[model samples]
Target: MAGVRPRAVVADDSHFMRSVISDILEDGGIDVVGQAKNGRDAVETVADLSPDVVTMDVEMPEMNGIEAVDRIMSENPTPVLMLSAHTDENADVTFEALDKGAVDFFTKPGGEVSMEMSRLEDQLVEMVTSVAEVDATAATGSEKQTSAPTSSTRTYVENPTLLIGSSTGGPKMVERVLSELPLEADFRVLIVQHMPDGFTERFAKRIDSRSDYDVREASHGDRIGGGEALVAPGGKHMIVSNYRSGRLRVKLTEDPPVNSVRPAVDMTMNSAAEVITDPLFGVILTGMGEDGAAGIKAIKAVGGRTIAQDEETSAVFGMPKRAIETGYVDDVLPIDDIPNGILNTAKAEVN
Candidate 1:
């Protein structure tokens, strides 16, 4: 009862919606510090209250969630959790909010609050708790650093292949992991991130600008190489196939959606398993849903090394949790330690 209790502000146009969210947070043992009726009020309240987290709604009077998120991030830098409607328009806005620094989002369930509240309550609590922790750590700037993976001392074939999957917080997570990796690391990394068209290109460009690695939107027939990262283009499925020269190359197609997602984690993971049979390193990072669980199982079945992001360090624990629960993960690591794990695993194969 003594550790830091999170203070959160709820922002929405409807009083009833705000009340429902406040109730959910309070039930989760988080303190409801304040409430706001619109984006403008939310920004003002956040500036004044300096709460640990802010739950913002996308459509509001006087201002919108994207503008409010930009203002909040620019002025105060507090963690933000966007409440988005379940629609394509809202999804687009949600991604924009993330690019502007909002940490995560929850899709507001349609229909009666009483009926859907129970279903969404857990998700709400999860987002609030995780974002609050991140906010507190950011404010103190004293978060404990994660330890890097040590050499395994095992020897294997040195054909290193990288498989990465991400969703909600993936752009940032992937960027951080790829940036921290050594520039000369010998491997080809294939990234499958849940995103819509027009966003993957921008996301890849952002990562490329921040990292030493050559990151780009993956193209059909693009040859995988060392010191580069390939992002699966939005709206397409990316697979790995063997090249005539025996190197793994990317194969893009308009395959039927798997796991309710086109460019799903399972598709990419299964494809990587087929093409890279030796010493594969598969990683499932922060995201929503169980899309990567099957893929991780496939990789593990083939003797590949598999890793999942620990729940405590993930923005959303759905994907990683599923993979971990399925017992497919060889290691469950914090986000910061993931890059080092990949390096250590890759190094282990070469030794």
Candidate 2:
């Protein structure tokens, strides 16, 4: 096992796609241990082979990817990477798959099958390899539900801003945190969940349906206050800047990606730290990279409070670990305790 390559099972209804994905993995140094033509086969194959990772197609005959994810997580609990198309339906199902315990998703550049598939070679392989290291069993069993805050104190911060950043295994944590917040909470939240185009809008809509705040995808020139939570749009960096009369607005830019990702959390949080005069809070959640570490430091340097999700509950500890190492984070709490921590910190700050 010392010299063995990581193993993967490629699952797709199309033979051509299966071949393409297998070749990509094998060429990228991963072994193609098994191939499945449908979701049912995918579950059985994974349960039998126990590959290091699984590349799952969103749509397949007999059983779709979402259902397969639920079944696999419930029965076998393997690390799964979803390959999704860029349509609204695929976007919706992809999130569902994620909620059911899929590790992460890679968007199909064009359609289900295209020459563009080759373009995804590097990113797809990286995702497959990265997710292979995740402890799927722990992730599947991690608590997803949050309860009411034990503390009854809520302090009103005038025009305060809260910036949240997350990546792999982030959507569920973001949703849970937002849902736990009371309806009257006044933080102007700007969320930077690492995602690609054609997905963030639907993600914001999903969160809005379940949360109390007026959550929506951020648009250029949109004001950043009045209890609104704006999710940074996919494929663009959202930066906060001072507008007329001391008001703040978000500006979307196609600036070069930082940390290999557009819509980078650093881009948004750093900007807000420079411009926002009101009380600020930075929350670093589960992710795979250090994009938010410097942003957390910048927020703390500007006298804003910072919190990070602890490793026991994080799907991936990279982002939160990096932020915690910065010596700037004021608190490191589990996912279940973060909403209350934020509120208590706000109350303590106000007092």
Candidate 3:
């Protein structure tokens, strides 16, 4: 009992799927302490069994994953890794679960099942193992999702080009920031959120539904304009191309992954820094690893405004924390203040 392998509960509505996941986890060396078929059962099992981590299904019966996540965090606060389907609607709910304080997520290889489900075995094991190691107490009191006041007195962005980057715990953090960006703060936003292939498109659609401006996945020749945003597709890199101040566009590249990940924030942030000269804003939010640290410095070399989400507000504080350590970050604000912080930086006079 003293040296038992870390225990986990596999939660899903389907028996076959649960068996598959349980086998993977057990084989990967974690003990399958319990299993649940629905959100309510998952919540209750977590309380009763108190496993090291929970693999939650995003769509479950009785009480959907979002509501269950809220209850679990409030009552038990155990680490949770969501398993989600790649659909626009589920994308919306997945982010909601993250917002409710789940540690991270892994997308199921396909909608229902296929031979490809086997591909997720290694990734699933890795996520569960790594997340089990997270000190959830360190991430307590995550920044509350709220809007910064948007008023005429706020600094005005002058044809600004905004670059956003994140990795772990990013989907919800990205959505929260984009959802609250002021309508009057018209700018072209390029985003690089580290996710697996085929997930970013749905993420973009989810943002589009809630954002005041148009939000969609970046393509080879998409025109970026005021009140428009582009999310880098998951498997391809996004770069600024055919650049004109008011008419910037993006192109996707199949170049190999950087920092061991495709669509690295450094790739897009550096690209945007190359083209945009005036009123550029670079924001590095919550994530793991140092992927964006160098790119934020690139923004600063050109006098672009750089902001990193502060440690207390970040889910992992790896990217933003590393960016801050470089001394390139102009401001280290909480997640809620980041959108407004960009506006304030944009309004400053550039000598």
Best by TM-score: 2
Identify the superior model by TM-score, candidate 2 or candidate 3: 2
What tens-digit string does per-residue lDDT give for candidate 1 at 1-351? 258789999998888888988999999989999999998999999989999899999888899888998888878888888887766667667778876778777767782233376676876797678777554234223334443332343332355778899886777788778777666565677889887666677778778887777889999988866667789998899988773333568889998988777799899888888767666788999877889899999898898889999887777778999999998798899887888777776664232
> What's the lDDT of the predicted structure labeled candidate 1?
0.79
Please give, for residues 1-351, the per-residue lDDT of candidate 2 as tens digits: 467688999999989989988999999999999999999999999989999899999999999999999999999999899999899999999999988999889888887875678887998887787788778998877575766543345555566678999998899899999888775557788999999987999999989998878899989888856567899999999999773333579899999999999999999999999988878899999988798999999999999999999997887889999999999999999998999888776764543
TM-score of 2: 0.94
Give the per-residue lDDT digits (tens) of candidate 3, residues 2-115.
Answer: 556889998889888889989999999999999999899998999999888898888888988888888888888888888888776777677778778888888887774334
lDDT of 1 at 182: 61
Best-to-worst TM-score order: 2, 3, 1
Best by lDDT: 2
RMSD of 3: 3.5
Per-residue lDDT of 305 in model 1: 84
Give the TM-score of each candidate.
Answer: 0.69, 0.94, 0.84
List of clashing residue pairs for candidate 1: none
Worst lDDT 10-window in candidate 2: 148-157
Model 2 alpha-carbon miss at residue 119, Å: 2.0
Q: What order do candidates take by lDDT, descending?
A: 2, 3, 1
* Candidate 2 regions with alpha-carbon error over 4 angstroms: 1-4, 142-144, 150-152, 243-247, 348-351
